[model samples]
Target: MTAAEAAADLAGGIIRPLFRSGLLVEAKGDASPVTEADRAAERALRAFLTERFPTHGIMGEEYGTERGDAEYLWVLDPIDGTRAFLTGRPLFGTLIGLLHKGQPVLGLIDQPVTRERWIGVAGQPTRFTSPMGGTAACRPCASLATAELSCTSPDIFDAAGTARFDRVRQAARRVTWGGDCYAYGLIALGLVDAVVEGTLKPWDWAALVPVIEGAGGRMTDWQGQALTLHSKGEVIAVGDAALLPEIVSLLS
Candidate 1:
């Protein structure tokens, strides 16, 4: 937790100043956006982690990998939602995750602009605090018909994935879009019931597992299997565990 907190502090310090400053945005080979804040925050985080745990492996969105074969690996996405940050939305966050032999065991989501943070450690309840005030608990919904659902964007889905996602969207009581990592945090706060997304990288969803599960929710692939480094990017997260089977069935 200390390491994750320090990483958040370092990343936030770099990110907060650049939001909406009209910084130059470049497109990566995949066409996703990148900015100086993302690169700088990640560089700072990598340096700290390297000094703090010299033998631990590190994988970052900005800078690829170092010591990838270590038993303890740190996964990072200094700015998880570059689009949101560029648009001056406080919904973007810094993600820091620790994987033990490829399984996530500790994670954090820090929204510096909103002063909101959520920490999740394996076998412990997720902790959350925000100046706006909310508890780190998920609300129960009797059925998908009553669930409030969110996805970062429908465009992330391919044709088949879109069909599957639409099945859940139609059954859900309401659907919200473009939440990015912030949507999963809402599930931890009991403000959102479920989120389904596709085309995610490990850094995109690794930290999310502990946060949601520690909040009495479940995070898994659409097939209902636990998420791991090797799993496909398709993901389904629900506040109510009972909802998992139904959601999996729908996606299947």
Candidate 2:
């Protein structure tokens, strides 16, 4: 928790001001959009983790890996929903996660613009803050037929993956798009029922596991396997654990 808090503090502080600043965005080699906000926030996070946990490793979206030999590593995404951030949607999130020996044990999702946060610890219920400064929890969803689903965008997925996700979306009662990391937090808050996403990295989904599970939900790969630091990144977050088998079948 301490590790993620520090990173979130530094990154959130740097990112909030840049939200709708018309900052120039540059594309990475993968054609993904990046901005000064992403770079600056990640830099702040890496610096704090280096100073506070020198023995730990670090991997971030803007910065590459460091100290991979360490037993613990910090995975970060200073801004998880850059597309939304660019459009001034306030739907972007700052993600921070801790992996002990390659297993994610802690995670946080912070939306600085609204001052909303969801902290997920390995063995504890998720903690949340709303704009009004009060507690929040996920409501129960008895079945997928009444479930609401989300994805950052169907466009992020490849042809095969999109088809699989479409099946799940059709199975669910409703679907919404373009939320990124905020969608996972919504699931934790019981505002959304499930989130199925593909082609994610460790920094993208690692922190999400604890938050979803701790909120009386479940998170795993689409195959229904546990997510490790090395998982293939086809993720499924569902408030109702019983939906897994049927959802996985659709995705499969």
Candidate 3:
């Protein structure tokens, strides 16, 4: 197994036992909910990465950055949807990503409860493994009017962002409210057509890039620029690259 896969397993093991166990929930400075599971899982992942990739840098949602200037860096979100996990919803996932020279070259999204994993590497087809069975190819989506659009939540957007999102929602044939990283995996699985979201941090999006792109999709900022470590976090991902021009126009 790859190190990313191992990291997902390690984090998932810590997380599964704590699911809906009524652990004390705390509020981070940003007011986001966090639990002991998130902290413990991240610590374990960090320890494993530090041992296995001694020279690579690490950036995690629960912990601060280390070796920030290293050419190769690992980005992790031990639990992408804390609310979903706290409520025993299985849609939450663990995200692991690797960046080389500031570009995301590898990404993995693992939904532990479902035992589904999506792995994407630069210049290669996205790979998916699940006992449930599915292909990793993106289904063709010709236009926004026929697309199934998804976003984690409307609450994450500001007034202006919400207005922009509403424009697309109005055009889409369907809209789903929450899935976080799991929804992105669905795009790789040919389930979801697109996801438009804003106010995301690096760890939140770093792992989604390769998965969508490698599966015959495209992920970029609302302005249509390629996503990078320095991106402003307005992400627009579509199963069909053809949808980008219309999506960008609507966002503008």
Candidate 4:
């Protein structure tokens, strides 16, 4: 909980002030936006993790990995939604996950501006702290036809991937776009039924596994296998565990 608290505090201290302040946005080689806020937030997180847990490795979105041979590793995506941040939308989140022997043991998703946080500790229920504090749990919705589906956007998919995603989208009751890591948080809160995304990174989806799982939901790769630090990046999450087979079938 110390690391999660530090992450939330760092987001509030370094990130919140930069929101909608017209921070300059630059493009990485992959054309993803990187603002000053993103860099600063990540730097602070990296610093804290290094100082507090010097032996653990650190992997971040802005700064690359800090190669360590420890049994534990810290993953950070200081700003999970740079596009949303650039557009002045509040759909972004700060993602922090601790991998113990390559499995996420603790994870957190914090929306600093909203002052909302969800912490997922392994083998325990996900805890939430919003303006109104409570725990997080996924509500059951076994039928795909009645599920509310969410994805970052349709443009992230390729021609073949798009065709597959279209099938999943069509199977759902409704689809919403542009929620980055916040969608998974919503799923944990029982506000969203399922979330499907293509081409995510380790830092992108690793933190979500424990959050989803702790909330009584299921998260996995498109093939429905468990997610690891080395998964192929295609992710599917369904609130109702029974819906997994059907969702995987559609995605596959």
What TM-score, to 2 decimals, does candidate 3 have? 0.98
lDDT per residue as tens, model 4, 1-252: 786787669766888889889778788998999999888988999888889988899998999889645688888899998899888899999999989998889999999888999888899998888997766989989988999999999988889889998988998899999899999999999999999998899899878888999999999999999888778888999889988888889877
TM-score of each: 0.99, 0.96, 0.98, 0.97
Each candidate: RMSD to true structure? 0.7, 1.2, 0.9, 1.1
Q: After superposition, how far is residue 8 of candidate 4 from its true place, in Å?
A: 2.2
Clashes of each: 0, 0, 0, 0
Steric clash count of candidate 3: 0
Better of 1 and 4 by TM-score: 1
lDDT of each: 0.93, 0.88, 0.92, 0.89
Candidate 1 residue 235 Cα shift, in angstroms, is: 0.5
Candidate 2 residues lying further than 4 Å off, grouped into runs, are: none
Query: Which segments of model 1 are wrong by more than 4 Å?
Result: none
